[model samples]
Target: MAKILVAFDTRDEGFEKLGSEHEIIRPPKGRDFTLEELQGLLPEAEVLCSVFDRPARAELLEHGTRLRLIANFGVGFNNIDIDYARSHGITVTNTPQAVIIPTAELTLALMLDCARRVSELDRLVRRHPGESTAIGRSGYLGVHLSGKTLGLIGYGRIASAVASRARAFGMKVLYHKRTPLSPEEETRQGISYAPLEELLRLSDFISIHTPYSPETHHFIGAQQFALMKPSTIFINTARGSVVDEDALISALQSHTIAYAGLDVFEDKDIPRLPLCQLENVCMTPHTGTQTADARRAMNEEMLENVARFLAGRSDLDRVV
Candidate 1:
């Protein structure tokens, strides 16, 4: 049996299938493996199961002399040094399928939260209990989802799921991607393909779902934000670096966009202080896949990749 090293501590029940077949090594409950501890354990590890937030740089990977595969727990694997791992003959895989539904659900939740001012209204109630006249009914009004246009930056699986849900809410969905879908496919999906500039100008709500990469870094910035309507609501559940945070902040401050709901940030899990202080923005701590169901699904997918690799299967979601 191959040695599998899990970099983070999680529910033991999630690993029952893998644990029964391999020599599994993990940190104590409630904590991740320290750098020093990982260094000592890596030399014997054949597979390194890593999380999305943690850095799996060459400095750490160099210690894994026996490492053959890296099964990332999240859909986005930007935290790992992909080039180094590729050169070192280490295959990388990610749990892309597992994150789709949960992330799409969170995207809809954020949209509703922003459109109806759910979180803002809840906060006001908590601060002024029984004070019905704390603010007039027109003081903090919210917009409606029906009859609104939602522009999606990417037309991947998650974006398609978001579009499906948005349509159910009576919102028109427009998507932009490297390639547009066929006319028949678009009709079936109930989405329209639009050029990026036109979508930004016409959309009432814009949601980013693109992956993070050098080419997509700051894909939305000053010029892009300037194209948005003054009453637009922005939502980003994808990687934070895809949209320039400084540009986004300026837009919110100047009302270039009416409001924003974000789940990810450029600083990884820690959002910037200025962003946190904004009243017009609704933020979650990158909780797209925070549900227990999502966790169990991701664990299963990661373990499947590890199992496929160990069994010499060619279709193991190999990235390298």
Candidate 2:
């Protein structure tokens, strides 16, 4: 049997679906692996599988002589040191298409919640007991999403899905992407291309679906925040580093933007940020890809990448 080191443990259900042929080395609860420990167990490990764990770099890959592919359980491979792995001929893999719908749905849900202040009101009704705001208050109250301009920072599969849902709510969608979509995609999706500044200025709601990279780091910063309307709501379902959290916190604190909804934060730990200090920004843990259907899909896809690579087929999750 080819020994495989599972850096982090996935649920038993996911493993069972992975089949029983390979010998898998599972990590313990909350136990982080040192280079020595990883080398000790599965010394001849051929493939490594994980969800969020990052393996030791440089010497670790050199030490892992038999390592061929790294099948990551999640879509983002940021946790792993990809550059070093690739240099040593180790193919890096990740589940990409599986979590699209789940993430898109969560993005829409967060947008609506921010527009309507749904979660706060729910908390008020539960905790306040007797005193409550008027249920039908208008004006500065809950804003209607219909007939509003929606801006997408990155026009990708998830953004297209969000646009579809927004269209159902009568939203006019605007997008800013490095490469614009085709004419059929524009017509079918009911979206218009705009420069980043123009889209930011015109949009009543700004949503980020961009991937995290050097070019995308701080895609939304002080300058970008200054361009948005005070009535606008900002939503980020992408990576945390894609946005500068300090700028977001300052914008919301100063009421430069009316409200913000974030499913992912620049920091993985949300409570540590000043986001909770404001009542306007609705925050959630990085749960955009956490739906049951999406989890199942990601698990299956991740395993398939491992299987495909082991079967001497093209590496499906090859990022490097």
Candidate 3:
């Protein structure tokens, strides 16, 4: 049996199927492993079950003399150094199938929260109990989205799901991918293709769904924000680094864009000071896939990848 070092604690029940076949090393329950702890454990580990919170850089991977596979716990494996892992003859895998539904749900939730002012209004009501006067239509008015345009940054599975939901809500879906979809596919999907600039200008609600990479880093910045309509409602359930937070904050402060809903932040876990302080912004601490079902599915998918690789099955989710 191989030695598996998990960087973070997860649902213990997910590992029951492994059935003591492999030795599993993990941090104490409710706590994540530190870099120092990871380095110390890697030398004896043949597999590393990594999470997105920590950076699996070359510097740390070098310490894993016995490491062969990195079964990442989440869909976005940007935190791992893919080139370095490949050069070292290590395989990387992620739980893409596990993330689709829950993340899409979170994207919709953020969009609705932004449009209806759910989070802000909830907080206001809680802070001032029995505040019936503010409930009137004249106060705290929010944007309506019955027949507005929705722009999707990436046309991946998550974005496609979001498109379906938006259409159900009477939204006109516009998507921008690196390559445009065929006319037939577009008609079937009930979505229209638009250039990035055109989508930014036309969308009443803009949601990002791209992965994080060199090309995508700061993909949406001041220039992109400048293209948006002042009444636009921005939503980002994608990697935070994809958008320039400073520019986004500036846009919100100046009313360049009406509001924003963010799940991930550029600072990994903690958001910047003024971002949380902004009344028009609603933020979640990267809980898109935090549900119990999502966690179990992710853990199961990752273990399946490990099982396949160990069984010498050539077919695997090999990113590197």
Candidate 4:
């Protein structure tokens, strides 16, 4: 039997449902797999199933002679040093397909919340002593989404899903991406490709869906915020660093932008930090891919990668 080490916190509620046959070693602490200690407990393990924490590093791989796979419980595998893992002959895989709709749905939720100030209104109602006729009129006045231009920063699977929902709501969909959608996809999704600058300038509700890469680091900064309308709303379900945190704060302070709905923070600790002090922003944990169905799917897929590897099959999610 192959030994599998689960290094981070995972309910793996899906694995039990999948009924896969394997010997699993789950860490006691939900998140105790620090680099310094991972190898000591899981010396003979053939796989490292990682959750939100960072995957095995080059130095850490020295303790991984038996480690053949690093199955990430995520879509973004940037946490793993791919090159180093490849050189060490360790395969990496991530659960991808299951989270598409759930993440898109969350993106839509954030976009709508930011546009209409949903979070602020909820806060308002809670602070007031009671719901009253005067309070209803004075508390919250939000914008409408119908007939608004909905901008998407990426045109991948999740972006396409968001465009579909936006279209159903009668919003004009505009996308700024590396490549134009195929003519067939454009017709199917009813979306138009626009220059990044044009999309930034024209969108009433701007949502980012791009991946994190060197080219995309801080893709939206103070200059980008300056291009938006004062009435514009911002939503980010993508990687946190994609937006410049300091620039976003500056823009919000200057009232250059209306509001922001963020799921992931540039610094993941922003929710507990001074950034959460602003009333114009709404944040969720990095939970776009955290729906029940998505979570199970991620867990199942990761385990299957492990199962297949032990069966003498090549690792399918190899980063190298």
Q: Largest TM-score belongs to which candidate? A: 1
- Worst 10-residue lDDT window for candidate 3 reads 129-138
> What digit string (tens of lDDT, one per residue) describes model 3 on residues 1-320?
98989898887756765567889898999988999999999999998989876789998899999999999988888889998998999999988888999999998898889898999888888898775736775778887778999999998999999999989999999999999999999999999999999999999999999988899999999999999999999999998999999999999999999999999888865789999899999999999998999989998988888878877787777777
**Candidate 1: residue pairs that collide:** none
| Cα lDDT, all candidates | 0.91, 0.83, 0.90, 0.81
In candidate 3, stretches whose alpha carbon ends up further than 4 angstroms from where it belongs are 16-20, 32-37
**Could you tell me the lDDT of residue 177 within candidate 1?**
96
- Name the candidate, 1 or 2, with the larger TM-score value: 1
lDDT of 3: 0.90
Count of backbone collisions within predicted model 3: 0
Model 4, runs deviating above 4 Å: 12-22, 28-37, 131-139, 269-274, 312-315
Candidate 1, residue 169: Cα displacement in angstroms equals: 0.5
Q: What is the lDDT of residue 195 in candidate 1?
A: 99
Worst 10 residues of 2 by lDDT: 9-18
Give the per-residue lDDT digits (tens) of candidate 1, residues 184-299. Answer: 99999999999999999999999998888899999999999999999899999998999999999999999999899999999865778888888888999999999999998998
> Who is ahead in lDDT, 2 or 4?
2
Question: Judged by lDDT against the true structure, how good is candidate 1?
Answer: 0.91
TM-score of 2: 0.90
